[model samples]
Target: MDKQIIISIGREYGSGGHEIGRKIAKLLDIPFYDRNLLDEIADAKNVDAKKLEKYDEAPSRMFLSRTVRGFSNSPSVNIAEMQFDLLREKAAAGESFVIVGRCSEDLFKEVKGLFSVFILGDYETKLDRVMERRSLSAKEAALAIERHDRNRKAYHNHFCNGKWGDSRNYDMCINSSRLGVDGTVEYLKDYVDRFIKTL
Candidate 1:
């Protein structure tokens, strides 16, 4: 890619989006930011990283609209704004990177070469994948997936005021179950290459 490209990925609970984002970054020879973002935010704000993880993809009722409107600050909301600022700073500095989740689709909208993608899989596929990865039974996996997806949806809606996983919210929405992991990565690499060309 001749331009400074930043690929932002949003994903469902058990979708292979994280792996796909990592693979795309590897293929494109760029840095990958995911959980690492929490660490960076933690450092910048002088807060413990482990505490930030709970607030990572969660929309805290305490920190939502009313609190935001009143400026009744909470650590979680403060961290989120700080992280958004950090993302903006990184993009402004012309870094080529792939960021998974963290609502980058809306956060980096003004970025010149940013391409946002959403990844999802069928219910059964996601349940099976979560079961295998987390060593949980079918019922347990389904519950875990539900909890995660709900949290993510709430988080995205709170932050972006948009429907999570709606195709309209992203530059592309890929069904990871259809292509599997490696195939999804290949598809995204091609999609991103074409997107860069358009720039």
Candidate 2:
């Protein structure tokens, strides 16, 4: 706990990854970044937060340009660059925090205390959670899940060196369905403590 450490999480839709990350940050007494990262980016860059939200985790529409060089001058790419720049600035300042998504694993690969994890749940478990949380029908929830995951995968794979949600790319992969939210947070806290000790 004395040293600066970062926990970056990637997760499937309805996997409770955001809840787990928030709980972990509270337990560790560190900053937690998720959707609110857009606000930070907006404030830092003096841009409209609403504009950033449109391309938050969605991949760029300029497929050909992004495919050629991993990025383009589009708003999506510019926003991603700003986000990465903010993270790098914070990391350089020795900040300890938990960030969910945004392909943070690859972004902080060189940082000594970076711990990256991916969270997934069984299809039925995720589907049920999405239905309840979003107040959608089962079919609607399933479609949303599919669309969100697809977009996330495309975004991460486009910006990162490794495949999105691939276990090999992360320090650990957890099945959130097995432990649920609180239990998963507890487990991660223990795991993170042990990891920091080793560091």
Candidate 3:
């Protein structure tokens, strides 16, 4: 097997971003972590995984509220932190993995090996993808797009102090909807192959 690598994906809602990460991982024969990151965290903390998922990558808008938002007096936060700490370690330990959301890029900011990417798409394109993927009515898709974007932006801004879709925070940024999911994955794989050879 090839040496492990870490791919951290930051995506706009409905951008077909998560699947791109997964495809890369699958093709590369590595672990793909999105919800699993939280699951692992929840496991270590012995907290309800569902509850953490609800607040996962979500933040309250008010600055003060955001400060206290993830701060639970319970052992949950500690467990989550420990799980994340392990993730950071694993990425550096050369286990090529795909990570979606949860600020994995930011959390592993100082870690040595990572291909950080930010995924984006036009508003309508995102809405269309969301409708198709989530099997939601157009109206429901619209609501999901708006709500998810807002929550994600707020969450990334709150926790990572970075824009959700900003290229500066990422090594590469791609418009996935334009490329479509499979095309996007192939593009990324090719990019990574070339990138790794140079490294």
Candidate 2, superposed: residue stretches over 4 Å from native: 63-71
For each candidate in turn, give its C-alpha RMSD to the true structure in angstroms: 2.0, 2.0, 3.1
Query: Per-prediction TM-score, please?
Result: 0.92, 0.94, 0.84
Candidate 3, residues 1-199, lDDT tens digits: the string is 4645678898888888887888898998888887777776667678778877655555653533322565654333344455567777776566777888877778877765678999998888898888888899989999998898888777677557677788888999888877788999999999888777755
Model 3 worst lDDT run, 10 consecutive residues: 59-68
Q: What does the lDDT come to for candidate 3?
A: 0.77
Residue pairs with backbone atoms closer than 3 Å in model 1 (clashes): none
lDDT of each: 0.85, 0.91, 0.77
Candidate 2, residues 1-199: lDDT per residue as tens digits?
Answer: 5898999999999999999999999999999998898998789779889878988888877644443466566777777777888889999999999999988999999999999999999999999999999999999999999999999998898889999999999999999999889999999999999989977
Better of 1 and 2 by TM-score: 2
Winning candidate number (TM-score):
2
Q: List the residue pairs that clash in candidate 2.
A: none
Sorted on lDDT, highest at the top, how do the candidates line up? 2, 1, 3
Predictions ranked by TM-score, top down? 2, 1, 3
